[model samples]
Target: MSQIIIDQLTHAQKVRILYKTILRLHRGLPEELRDLGDKYARDEFRRHLQCSPMEAQLFMTEWAKYAVTITSQLGLKGKAMGTIGGELDSNTVEMLKEDQVIQLYELMLAAKGLEGDTITAKDIHNSK
Candidate 1:
């Protein structure tokens, strides 16, 4: 049977959980691309792949472009800003099911107050 995640979190727990998951998705990219994604993001890469340097340099540049687009579209900011997504900010994830983690990320984005354009994990954590 398939499991539905995110059925286990509180409203506050949901946003943070989602942000961490998305950030992980971003960190999974190749090193070169990951670096670029950290700087510029993925969408930017699509527009300027030629401007990128050859080999690893080119990889980082292009990948950054990809990272940016993904983060922006996903409503992620800061470390979450580029291709690498965002950082994990909570311990609650271990308590939830795997699918719940995914759902939490989506819900965080879908939540009304959580839809701001500049929310970062640090900001969320520091506020507490």
Candidate 2:
């Protein structure tokens, strides 16, 4: 749907659409990522259930972008399995708040099936 039409939707309506869209798009993902993506999307949405209106707007916008991005990648001709989206660029990472960066790091670990492993400032420093 067009941006204008989407903008006309109520918050709840938008939420339902985007939430279903993301989960549905996950069906096109490789098996491992599909499971992880489904859980992550559900957790994120549930966590934001009572967020402020401004926060809700930002949340929806980002997820909307993710939907568009993944849809395009999945639509590619003869796309390889297990290859979907690429890594976040440095500039994007630089724009994230500390908590978001930490969440991103934890997500990376989870995606690698390395649960319970945590990073520290020392580890980050040593990696440089």
Overall lDDT per candidate, in order of appearance: 0.46, 0.84
Model 1 lDDT on a 0 to 1 scale: 0.46
Put down candidate 1 lDDT per residue, 1-128, tens digits, no spaces.
11355566553354344334444655655555455334432343344435533443444543445444565644333333333335445665555555545445544554333543454556444534
Worst 10 residues of 2 by lDDT: 75-84
**Model 1 lDDT-worst window of ten:** 76-85
* Over 4 Å off, model 1: 1-5, 32-128
Relative to the unseen true structure, what is the C-alpha lDDT of residue 44 in candidate 1, on a scale of 0 to 100? Answer: 36
**Best-fitting candidate, measured by TM-score?**
2
lDDT of 2 by residue, 1-128 (tens): 89999789898998999999998888887788899999999999999999999999899899999998888788554343456788777788778776777778788898999979988877554533
Model 1, 37: alpha-carbon shift in Å?
A: 5.4
Stretches of model 2 off by over 4 angstroms after superposition: 1-8, 76-82, 124-128
Best by lDDT: 2
Q: Clashing residue pairs, candidate 2?
A: none
Candidate 2 to truth, TM: 0.83
